[model samples]
Target: MDIISCLPGHVIDRILSYLPIREAVRTSVLSKIWKNKWYTLPNLVFDKHGVSDVASEDSLVDKNKIVKIVDHVLLIHSGPINMFKFTEDDVIGEILVTDMDRWILHLTGRSIKELVLEFLTGEEEEEYYKYKIPWCLFSCQSLHRLTLQWCWLNPPKVFEGFRNLRSLDLNLVTVAQDAFENIVRDTSIVLKNISSRKGN
Candidate 1:
């Protein structure tokens, strides 16, 4: 009926892909055609502290809301998620770790190419713990680029995967020397570039 609405579904999906995850998701309510477009988006971002300047109470509410939104997106997303980015906060606590494991496991089922996971820094409470990058990541053969900031790395003894990985960046991550070497040894064939906070 409308010129904009008549555009090809792929074209529409491409256009919607550029917008922020939240804004893109909102477009779903515009009509039935656009209702499920968000689910097919290949890229999804969840920045937990989007409203940092807001009051303390409001920020907590927004953070919790973000966690719930992430749950829904990862669960219902129907298309292959090429990239996934999320910011973790300590306020969410131990529950967030379980949720992240589940999320990563879900992504492994698809052909994910790029993964960026950053944890919020500054609070002393959150300082006590760092979310360990799941061992399952080593088995993700589709992963080409990976980045982790303020997270922990514990490579498993049986680690053997990421043959497609080309770039890896680990910033401010606490990792054992031998464990780190193990990761490099496994991916040395295809991994060309790697930078970690501990080293130059």
Candidate 2:
């Protein structure tokens, strides 16, 4: 048996967290001891380099593959997801929103601590198409840090705030004056850092 495998399970999980998510999952093939160890990995990152399968000479990513990969991982994930980061610039119009909504719905009850959702597009088209984040995201009280880029933020009228959220980073996001006021003015939240901007 390897010396590293003998280390405590928490130590192993910590070690795996440092590796790229793809490499971390590949560790399951190393041996029986490592099998399924990644299922409990708290941090999940889905980005171009990590999950993309370039489909053609044009260098476009296969969106369907990415969606399937996310679905499979979340379906089998066994423990609370402390952090989930998803960055995809090639997400097609409305399809991406559906998948994102479902994923957020799944993560809500899992006590996710940090959430990052970024979708990049051509600057000209960006203003016309901003992802409206799923309403469930605003209800996630476990979120400690939230970063959203190139999306529209319109929380429900009854929404209060993320009670545990300490940091909020909004880049190129559009929120109505009333909605923005409601989010920042909540007494229940003591945000340590709040950054917002209107993109050109």
Candidate 3:
């Protein structure tokens, strides 16, 4: 009579993987078997508000809470993770950056295969916006897919050790065409595809 029992394991896994990490963790209450199943999911997607619901009009979600959730998930996760996606508002403060760096380092150590970092920038002058990609990501050997959105790179960041990389997507990010070209050209790994769209 269990609802989970009626679903195929792969189907259930796919459904659970799409849920935010917190909601996915909560699924453990369904049953003991379900609890273990959540830990085996190969994809990990995190959003700014995933760990905490509290945010002031001018503040971001708590960084400490995010670190705790990431640590807890990595601690219990079984099997190799396939993807890590992070989406955040562009107004990140100084304190949050430090915690975010730690979290990124943790994921890279796990040999993640795909990484998507999306920063949502509100209506603002292009000249006034800037973003720095954490360097730890460039060292991930297992990373095969990378996506960056609404981000800017100063002095530009170069990606290396991604021998398996096949796809790259950059959307609304400000980088010289040459720098962008250098990234794709240097890879020489038959980049499967590259796509970009201008930011409004």
Q: Write candidate 1's Cα lDDT for 1-200 as tens digits.
A: 66666778988888887787777877887777888888889988777433233225655565566667888888788988999988765433575778888888888778799998888654434544677778787788898788887776776777754678777777666675567766655545444334343321
| TM, every model | 0.82, 0.86, 0.72
C-alpha lDDT of candidate 1 relative to the true structure: 0.72
Residue 69, candidate 3: C-alpha displacement in angstroms: 3.0
Q: Residue by residue across 72-173, what tens digits does model 2's lDDT show?
A: 899989988999999976534666678888999999979899999888844745566777788898898998888887777888889877778877778777
lDDT of 3 by residue, 77-192 (tens): 98788887777665555665676677678878988888887766645565344455677766776877878776654323454245667787776666544555544554555543
Assess candidate 3 and give its lDDT.
0.67
Candidate 1 error regions (>4 Å): 48-60, 89-92, 122-127, 186-200
TM-score of 2: 0.86
- lDDT for model 2, please: 0.78
- Give the alpha-carbon lDDT of every model: 0.72, 0.78, 0.67
lDDT of 1 at 42: 90
| Candidate 3 segments whose C-alpha is farther than 4 A from its true place | 1-8, 48-58, 61-64, 122-129, 154-161, 176-178, 186-200
In terms of lDDT, the best-performing candidate is 2
